[model samples]
Target: MTAPDPTTAIDPVTAAVIQGALETIAVEMGHKLMRMSHSSIIRESEDFGAALTDPTGSQLCECRMSTPLQSGPIPGYVRHILKVVAGRGDAIRPGDVIMHNDPYGGASHGPDVAFCVPVFHQDALVGFSVTTAHHLDIGALTPGSCGIVDAVDTYAEGLQFKAIKVYEAGRRVDPVWQILEANLRAPQLVVGDMEAQIMAARIGAARFSELIETWGLAAITAAHDDLIAYSERLMREAIRALPDGEYRAVTHLDGYLDDPDPGRRDLPLVVTLRIAADTLEVDLTGTAPQLPDKPINMPFEGTVDCAIWLTVRSILLDSVTFGHIPQNAGLTRQIRIVAPKGCLANPDFPAPVIARFCPGNQLADTVMKALAQVAPDRVSAGIGNLRVASFSGLKDGRHWVHMEILEGSYGGRQGLDGMDAVDTLYANTRNNPIEDIEMHLPLRVTRYELREDAVAPGRWRGGIGTVREFTFLSDGGFSMEGDGHSHRPWGHDGGADGLTASVTLVPADGAPRALVSKIPYLKAKAGDRLVCLGPCGGGYGDPLARDPEAVLHDLREGLLGPEAAFADYGVAAMPAGLDEAATRAERGRRIVSPPS
Candidate 1:
């Protein structure tokens, strides 16, 4: 009998089952990668993403633990690979695994290596299984291949691969492997991670093939289409709920690389969000020009993808029924982005983009600020900066590179305070455990604790950031990529702004010195200590409006000090049954003459 039309609708129960199965396969693929990987970045921190896509390169299901920044760009990476293969007249067959990590070629960044494997059944390509992970090194001037804010161009950043077949016909490509092994300083660790990525893709492909067999190719394809359509419908309905209008927000970067002038900050990122009946558009027209020598530029595709993902998460996913909707290409169908060429959002070719995550996260924050005007109930205040630090040097007579992404605070919302000591916004990776760091590298965690007075006080207090101090066991080179050292996270409504991020270097015998937000490279002695104070999130409403009991609870929890409780929240402590009269008088006085 002829197969049913793949585009036709499938039953709801079967469609849900297929969706769950696809997600399960993706999760299994992630587990396999982490279990088999050698590097602590992948195995311990779990900085990786996995997904299953249809033949046309649309995502069907992604691993639940995948980073939002990494997973959203896989479909674009797949399409770019397909375009290159088609240009060269290359055939994509079963057992073929492709690898790429070129930012200009539609990758998120150079360090994030991606692998795509085609799943075939009945001698026909049905879908793809893909994985992307941040490798420890890729033959860059710096050890981690990232955190080099002063990188003048892409050449100084790291190796760039444009859609190359790493495995053909189930056989490893020796030349590609040799190139990778020769380039990276940590060849064994890097190659081991690559091998794990390949294995994950292969396992995903095999499981997907089995799924196709059990459900039949036609039924599987039908379910995929149905699920995407359902997601699109839900997204459109969510968009329709917002009042149709144009909202604009502008935020600035703190500073650029190699600029000696302390007051020299980059131009502001201007985002104009237009909300129509059932559609949304993000226009980055008046943004700053691209910086050729700094690693702050961003690719156009990446910028668009980031904007779309932020919009979906803030608007559609925030809805009650749409909270469980599948995230696929269809959800972005109603979204449009216009980022002019040579702008900070869409930079020109060869511009260093190793530190693009700073601007990318800023773009998300700008979008949130714009949406807050129309959708206050659905939006939150600004979060912390994106901080990634890399430490490298000679250890045991072998070159070593240890990279770690620090966690920051999340912004406060309507009813709840922001999450504390967690990865905020676009980042979804876990903090590297102190035990893992000490075990893998020559470093010691001296102090890791929550900053006591760093939270933004409001009716619902903002999340507090951490204060981590690391001491090198040996002389090493350190690099940092981050932002928001000067400007703090802005609160919404009548809330207060959050604390800014800061870093300091304290030598064993010398005095302490302050460090910039982005540092190219710094040499440290064996006894040197690096103190990183993360940025706290912004509050949601006025602190004076907070309940007295809530303020007392914050004081009891140590999130707010006793002095701040009396000053910010107008709450005073007394032995007599609660000083309610003094608190009321303090609040009334603040209402008449608010603190400037």
Candidate 2:
């Protein structure tokens, strides 16, 4: 593990001030990108992250709007770019920006477009501002990068751009633009969004240079070093808080429907976390074999790094005693990863990985579950996996795709219940507004409402799930992909399980049709509708321990219906015409649970 010199110190006030300035710049960069970008993912879903990196490629800070995953592997990505550029460490000139999407070559998932812009001062490279946004259309083999789940190679996944300069000497590279534009379905939109990325990088570079001007080069560099050191120290302290031992965990993925190989069953991902004196090691040695035909493999290092961040963040946020560890590269110093070759985490060439996030989130879940054994009070039950439902086809002679990324509820904790209708982990983005969807695409939200009695029953009831129904204006097709249906979100500490997710389509026929995990291309005529119900959160504690008054409150708010009140919380409702005294008498006759 890298260590910061103990002799060096930064004033608390100065550190806070620098952090605030960097945060402000990050927010501004995001705003600039969103304002200029043409992609719906950028302007609406906001499926991107931004950060400022030191000259050495180390992440200095991430903005509040940015995600921890975005900052985790950026240093790796930068180093990979340098290697591909023929060891030209200093060749990255001022006003030049590089872009790449080689996941195997140390980038994020296939659809996440990344750019690194070098900052120069006095003709010397000072730092690099990196930004990555999820492009809705990246000229993939399949439209919107959906389908092609049975792909056999990276080429089938999408086009791969090696580490190349997209901008040089403040001018956009003509050849790069021509090639990208020629291959994409929406050429103008792609080029426009790429330009937006360049602008965002420029914004970050200018802000960073301004900071240097305000606080001489020496002071800024010292501050950067101090920040890294402080983060490492705090992370080590957090590690010390955990018991020293080896803990093993494992999670399974819903097998791909397109895999021709019949021998493979549901893919199981194994994760082992070793907590030592000052370091935490995550090993994926015993993980399942890589699937050459399924789109679920991930770069080993990226997965391990992201999993560690999620687990550590959950502990800090949920713990009674949290630490001050900075969410930057310094936190990574105390964490080590080992992903053996040919495993799901470290697949070889030709492994389809368009849907790597499935196993990635599962890996995080397994690690967190293992950590919960040692720190039960600080951890909650499992959350419903990310549900990515997409609708795509030609609408009014123009091709479009609409994705409803549902953020299901989180698991409940020892003292409190889990959050509902919100994904609390990686890609905590919002659902695209119905208004935006209808206006941009050929779909309308027919019905959007909360699912009734769809929560897991417990003393502390699990969160209720939600449902979204959509109808098509044209006879387009739809597809749904996700997990946590066959396997509901699991509870902990004698808690109850959460409800599983379900999807159904309403036709202009006899009855609503139910769909499976992986839906093929199904044509939806006009007046036809699709309904999606996301999973509920797992419950914490015994159901009988919940207060009756709380149950009544949930009943009043309509979060819990009468059936759930009686079945899950063991609370019966009073008669409609009963007075308070009569209701109390009736309650006294039926309330048999202990004090909560």
Candidate 3:
């Protein structure tokens, strides 16, 4: 393919068509990766990302199936990859597959590794294709990646792949592959998943090259710029429609509740949104200081920025409101993020960050809470935070790692009840199948159900969390990283606050023990079991104003007990149904008494 003349004018219809072609290429990449993956985390949970970017690392398109945390950081990954290569006096060559996972550089953490493939047309570099996924084991100190919550420094977390070339000039880097296989616990599985990522990225690169060939270089470039501009215009108009003002919100994370140091527990996260005209600035001026030895600090470029951008995009330019706005670099052009160095959101170099996922999600929720002040109807109330547990053990003298993302609930919003047993905010990953767990590893899913009688009460009641129990069929070791245990999810308006999460470790013979939000690795017997209770979301509106019929329905469904409905919703319930006159009288008496 050759570059066409620069003077030819491209029309809008061609631009829209080109935009669609780019999106199609990304979707294809995601499908290919999932089919080729070895671990259930990527194959079934869909905790991976695929995207295309310009030479300068501006994201052109992304796979909708991937999590925001994985795909949203592609642009950052590219810029850092290019910079690292350049700083080392190296260059990105055709057929070169580069690996980079520097949390301080552009990666969310060490576990979420990225693979990049540069595309060339007629010896001229046009763009690059990239894929990122959370590997089951990145040769961390422990057997799994997600539960390395006790690392005191980056070096202790795991291997840091900084701009290493796994493939150069279309030839395999044998030594790099050998190093990875030697260090990783599950070499066959981890390396296979990684190779899958490379294949998917190469497919994207080929598709992007074909796009340049089909539309001519000149037309493709013009259309790309036009689509970016259109997205920017839509964002500007949305910002203009909002009542411009400063919105501030404060939230906390349950950091190291078992630790002796008081500074590590109950960490505060503050967000101040300065919305003026068409631009938004997220200032993290009062967030908690980074823990010198904790792995929960968030990376500024990858984790923090992704949290802020994804939250604002979902709220302001939601698909329901403006339809499918192009997901590209221009959507983030008008927004600026600022987090002071040494804070939890923008930790300094060498600070541990393996367990940054939950904190980053909380930061996103804080941004949503602040914006709810201006866009009440468009936003949900406080959201239930997620939890991760790494279940690992030995089977026939071989190691097995399984990371489970316990589902969190959604807060109630205008005209709708919160969603139940779902991943919230930036951590959008599906639950691993029970069959997959049993077939591959020596584990059993003893129980799985929704939390009974734990619903948050409101006009639109909050979503309920789930109850999951896992039993070990063999001796094993495991760890955990999570939040929402100490502080309850905050409620909006006059709604009731939500419930916190709890984890219990039950021995086959001994009594059960309560575990904190974050736990280090511990040995388990053959019959050991873990019972996880996901956090519930905060409610919305006044519970007394909730429809009497809704309260009766909840009672009939057993979502809430009769005592809860009578006390919280001020409803008088009968065996048959709601008693209208009795309910009204009860509400009036409750209003008159105003329970203290």
Candidate 4:
């Protein structure tokens, strides 16, 4: 940031206009990348990020379509890129696109690669335009990247590109491109995606330069600087609203349930929020120790920090209250994060973190659970964690890989019911369309719908999870990383706990068998089927406080059985409309003599 001349200070109108323009440029970059990408994960599921950052590596604007996990770590990527470049005694030049995916440095995982382009005006560095996406394969032990649950170390995950220039001074670096293509399993698709990211980042850079040209560089800088301060002020005010105290909560993840070692499964994620006047601190001191051989450990910069900040931002300055505050670095200025070294949230280097997606998300859920003590109205009940599956197989001497993000349910809150069958917390990814899956891959979606009678009862009922059944059209292998199998989403107030997730394997002709939540790459027959049952969300308020009419509505939709209506909510059902007299009597009876 440059010194602001008192005579020509930027007005609020100009600052707001500049902020909106930067956001639009980011959104455009995201659209271009998605349109030009080859893999279903990027094009269909939209698992990518595009953002603009200042020369000092502070985020200015991010694409709204991108997930929090992807965009939130961009500044860290740029900062670490600068560190790596400086350590190697190299300079960033115009037309040079640097590729980075070092988990220990800033990346969320080994699979989410970032392509960063430095923007310059008149041969002076001004900002950076970057795009990051989750690749299908990175030449790991297996064909796919998402479900590499058994990776022993970071070296086993895949290729690691740290500050490598794919394009240097307008010249193509053929060797870097060649090395990438030769290593990946799906070379054509992965390379195509990387090229698309390059073009999109370049487009973002061009748009940023255009803005600087339209409004002088000083004016642009002044506007953003003022904007950042305004955001900080908003956050500080939000912090002041909460009572000063320490709030704590604990949640668990089903880390390697099949492992014989007890330390590998049912791992705990502990969070404590310390609030004082206008500042807050998040400490992950009680989290489980790092799993040396597992890839479930989260990176402190990319995964762990993003998880905490995303939850705090969502809870404090919610859209309804703040009315679309600009997402910049200032919002996090007043928040501090502390995680004990060697814990799951902050692991040592070379601890494999390729499969950190689900556990990182559960960490976000844990933060929400902790903050709920102070901000009850601004939070939800315990959320059902998500699952990811990588489906891969060979056909006619070639390989095809697909990464699917299974949706999870949200717990009910305040006056609203929990969202049903959607990606919860920081893993905000779209579900792959059934047509896209069957048309492009050798798979069949036999069943896709809401689970029957899966409602979590409350005044505002919790969300319902979906049941997905996938059958292999040909012989293939699949692996999954997920949680919420051993634990249920915690209920709020007097609400009941939510349901748990499970997976069932049914062979072509043999008896069906139950499987753990996380699955390693395993062979399957052509006619074998896998049934995924999603966890139901936890309810908010008391189930007895729910309206009888709402219970009748769920009954009509086949979401609740007659026995459940009477037992869970104490609402008797009849053949006609509602047995109001019976419901009143039952509720009164329960109020007088509560059931354990």
Candidate 5:
């Protein structure tokens, strides 16, 4: 007997039904993980993703709430797992669950644990169900297994698992769980989260099996093939619409550990995009060399995934087009990536990657900027990068790790103002609620509000970042991992640049002191206050051309100060309304000789 040809086209109605059913399974898997997880990071912030893939590890569908960064890499992660198991001559069974967190083994980072289970129909492997979530503790130098800026290599980062089986034949592997538990600070939470992932994978596999049983394997496989082909066609059509040309842009990371002043050193990331007919390619040949001691390096496969995501988001923003296009391997049919070896984006082995999010976000921003040269109306200005801060310590003889993702402003687009105090790009994880933080850890929320006057003024004003301050209830240490400190977010079309990010530590009886953007650790006593100020987003269009009414509204809302209104927008701060004549005179004067 021979296998049925997958190229046989299925009815469009059946194909759409199967596609929707697969997507629902992925969503249910994520909901299961969230409901059963022990960590607040997974339950509250929702830092997880779930997906379904074919037997060869090609993604079929993903959960709607999954992070783009995580979902993009699911296929690669699954392929890596299959290869590893094949080398050992191990047979993957329906009840088996595989787990890994090694960055070199196709994971996003050490903290993001991935679990995959083989979905079988009639004792034959048909597909895989996958789930990935950020665990709070992974036995790293820090509590959250991240924000380590000074780590020299992967050994200091955390415990790494390279494609190991955590369950077999529907039974938990006690030894594997024991070894993981022995190394983690919060063993109970870690094991609980791992079990939650396993449960999610199981749910996914079971649901997929039911679909196969109901519809038969031949029809389902045909539908899968048709869906992938349809998406590839759509992606190619989208790419063909762009003019054939080369677009290039450059951006920089703020700090390196080896420099005399880490803040003063700038690491460049250059991107060149080539579009021809129906294909697009991104080359990162001249990017900065990998840092030996800093934790800013990213894995090559993860970097490629980030590039693919940016391209999809930029070209397919419409609901009708995006809805029909499958979020799978087909999306990459028209994209090619060239990342040079040993660059920061594709670093060599042994380099620390706990802080890779900084460079990853910058890569996405750089690609958008390059595309903006040709599609100015379709692209937005630069956005403030993600700033992750972690607070951890021992309390009541138990360890507590509180990792918070501070929200940054997004750049304003052609006709729309940027979103205010929100997560941008790859760092779209939700902000941890103040009440949740206070209830779970030894900290008090002091301030949580938008930074005033931090937005860049333009025709469409950029969004402002937020300020989050915390007072310690007990002695603990804090670690900062992010970028966008020395360099400001760039504005487009003659708009003004946005503000940079900063951290301030104020003692109870002493003055405030500035801290570096990336810190291995900073000890603080009870009653000390730590404030995290996020960077603002860049604006779109000229600030001088901003409407007086918009400027006045900003004034009333406290986002734009009186001084900034007069200096950037040439608008007078009047008691009742704008001084129309004074505004006209100021605009005319500026038009004669624009401020350089």
Candidate 6:
């Protein structure tokens, strides 16, 4: 007998084909999650990501819809499961589906639920399938999965399923159901959502196994290895394109630990990404201090995971031409991330991190700035901040939890303007439909329209912001916390800063009032209304570079306001032929040196 050559086992072409198949399978896996999920967060809001991994737990391929926010943690989560299973001296038999939510246990965010299932071939563990979904209710002390800050420990956050086997050998465990029901407020929905996650993992595992069988394990493994290497190469090429140098940027948060407060001035977070030929290094040594008492504190490891994924997602989402680049461990072969211990990104276990994105978003902005130092044409000015809106109250005498999240505008890039009212780089979830929300719950959506006069004016105007108003049909009860209202999204180059976010409350009798940046809890009564808005993305270039006709078209199409058409853009809305000449003359007369 002679040893076989790996190349002979699986050619690179076949391996590439298998990789494509796995990518498609990942999308199907997500569809299963959407169909089976119970909460609006996972189903209607589409806040979940799915991926395929090797038996030892390395990410191979994922879906585009998974978004930039979720790519970092799946592999880490799988590694944790493998460690736990190996330490127990027990084999991961088929049907041994385990779930973990502890942010310390490899979760990107607390609400993101990770489901792991091991695939077995010939009575041996061949590979693993992992799925993570943002579950709305984890039986937390708060109404939704946003954990309560008042709780003394994790128990108050919700039921903890620590490496607990929810399903065993392809069968649902009885005790698991009892335990889940005992903790979660919406027992039926929570358990149903979990089942949906299991179904997704099962589909992924089955499809992966079929590929391995058809192509043989050797061929499949070779493809996996080749794809990983190819991804690393492509990323290195991208890195090498940038001149070897150090680039730095910094961002701030409204506040880390305060509820119903504007937040302490600004919580600074500095980002420094070094590109040296084919390698990149990201350091967060000067980041802000972790909030010892706030729910915004997340394990530093989770932060590192999120940041890396954010960078990759931004690059890919910004351009489809970059799709050829594989997003596996190889892509980060030249990347090194450092976050000082006890900082916001990496902290001790059980640190309250319900609002991880507050600082996380800042980290992303800083990273973009660092990238822009070298690749200005490749990056866009900051856009409206992204936030998940939480709404929970009493319905029909029972406690109910509902959350509505929004994706605001993104600033334009070098050539094109940013997209409007869309999910930023961090998340790719959908907005819950007004009809779905009103019909299923006791709330009414009075006004859900784009907020005018919210765009940052420039040669190419930034994307417009959005405004939403909700009327409470039942008693008042709910609270919210998010960013971008106080610290507006900054424009790059010559673009101006976007509008600040706003939230207002219309009382049954009293005048409407402005809302604080973050809210832990607020008492409510029937007929009270809640309105929230998102900021606009920043703009690029001098306002003079914009086309006058484009500005008029925006006015005609409702994308731009009349005031913007005249003031920021310098386009006059005059009457017909004379108007065009007058507009030009007016623009010429007002010409002055650009702002310093």
lDDT of 3 by residue, 58-156 (tens): 888999899999999999999999899999998878889999999988999999999999999899788889999999898878889987888879998
**In candidate 1, which residue ranges exceed 4 Å CA deviation?**
1-8, 261-264, 319-321, 574-578, 593-596
lDDT of 4 at 515: 89
Candidate that scores best on lDDT: 4
- Candidate 6 at residue 504, lDDT? 84
Which stretches in model 3 have alpha-carbon errors above 4 Å?
Answer: 1-6, 592-596
Clashing pairs in 5: none
**Candidate 5 residue lDDT tens string, 229-321:** 777787788778888999899988886533696543798889998999988888887888888777788887754466546555554444533
Between prediction 2 and prediction 6, which has the larger lDDT?
A: 6
TM-score, ranked from best to worst: 4, 3, 1, 5, 6, 2
Q: Which 10 consecutive positions of candidate 6 have the poorest summed lDDT?
A: 147-156
Better of 5 and 6 by lDDT: 5
The per-residue C-alpha lDDT of model 1 at residue 184 equals 86
lDDT against true structure, model 6: 0.73
Q: Give the C-alpha miss distance for residue 318 in model 1, angstroms.
A: 2.1
Steric overlap count per candidate: 0, 3, 0, 0, 0, 12
Q: What is the RMSD of candidate 1?
A: 2.7
Candidate 4 steric clashes: 0
Candidate 4, poorest ten consecutive residues by summed lDDT: 1-10
- Model 4 pairs whose backbones collide: none
Error of 1 at 326 (Å): 0.9
Worst 10 residues of 3 by lDDT: 1-10
TM-score: the better of candidates 4 and 6? 4
Each prediction's Cα lDDT score? 0.83, 0.72, 0.91, 0.91, 0.82, 0.73
